[model samples]
Target: MAWFILIFSGAVEAVWAAALDKSAGFTRLWPSLIFLVACAISMGGLAWAMRSIPVGTAYA
Candidate 1:
């Protein structure tokens, strides 16, 4: 389950990264918000996983 969360988080990171580009410096409000939310969720999940797994292993 933790591994799954980590993988899902990575996917979310990709989504936010693309959305950030699409936002174009916060000019697009909705996309920028979406990117911020996604990034927060992704980082939170990653932080949770790091509690139990080694950073390198979680990344792997």
Candidate 2:
């Protein structure tokens, strides 16, 4: 469901934010990779969910 993907994406966004902090300016390899991958998944999920959900409601 679109709502499920949107919620999952939002949760991943938190992981992305935390991994970004752990990345140490991208100096740390593992955390940096995690950040990059999380970013991709979060954005991709948002895009996919948007196909079924309206942008305004999804954003809210």
Candidate 3:
């Protein structure tokens, strides 16, 4: 379960990274919003997984 969350978080990280690229330094409102939301979701997933995963392993 923790590994699943960690993997899901990584996928979300990819989403946030792509959204950030589209954001163009936040010049565009929609893409920037997408980036922000994705970033939050990604971090939230990572943090959630941290409850069951060791920090070192989670990072890996």
Candidate 4:
């Protein structure tokens, strides 16, 4: 479960980056929203995964 979430989160990180780029300095509403939501999900997953996986291994 943790591994799945972690992997999903990693993939979401790419989406987050793309959204951030598409946000156009946050002037674009939809992309900005997607960026925020993706950031939250990615961070949340990373935190949750950290509870089960070692920080070093996860970071590596």
Scored by lDDT, model 3 comes in at 0.90
For model 2, how does the per-residue alpha-carbon lDDT over 11-53 read when each residue is reduced to its tens digit? Answer: 9999999999999999999999999999999999999999999
Q: What overall lDDT, based on C-alpha atoms, would model 4 receive against the true structure?
A: 0.95
lDDT of 3 by residue, 8-47 (tens): 9899899989988988899999989988898898899899
Q: Give the least accurate 10-residue stretch of model 3, judged by summed lDDT.
A: 1-10
Per-candidate TM equals 0.90, 0.95, 0.91, 0.95
Report the C-alpha displacement of residue 15, candidate 1, in angstroms: 0.8
Residues 1-60, candidate 1: write the lDDT tens digits.
788889899999999999999999989999999999999999999998888889998876
lDDT (0 to 1) per candidate: 0.91, 0.95, 0.90, 0.95
After superposition, candidate 2 runs with Cα above 4 Å error: none
Candidate 2 differs from the real structure by a C-alpha RMSD in angstroms, to one decimal, of 0.7
- Of 1 and 2, which scores higher on lDDT? 2
Model 1 bad stretches (over 4 Å): none
Clashing pairs in 4: none
TM-score of 4: 0.95
Q: Report the alpha-carbon TM-score of model 3 versus the true structure.
A: 0.91
Which is superior by TM-score, 1 or 2?
2
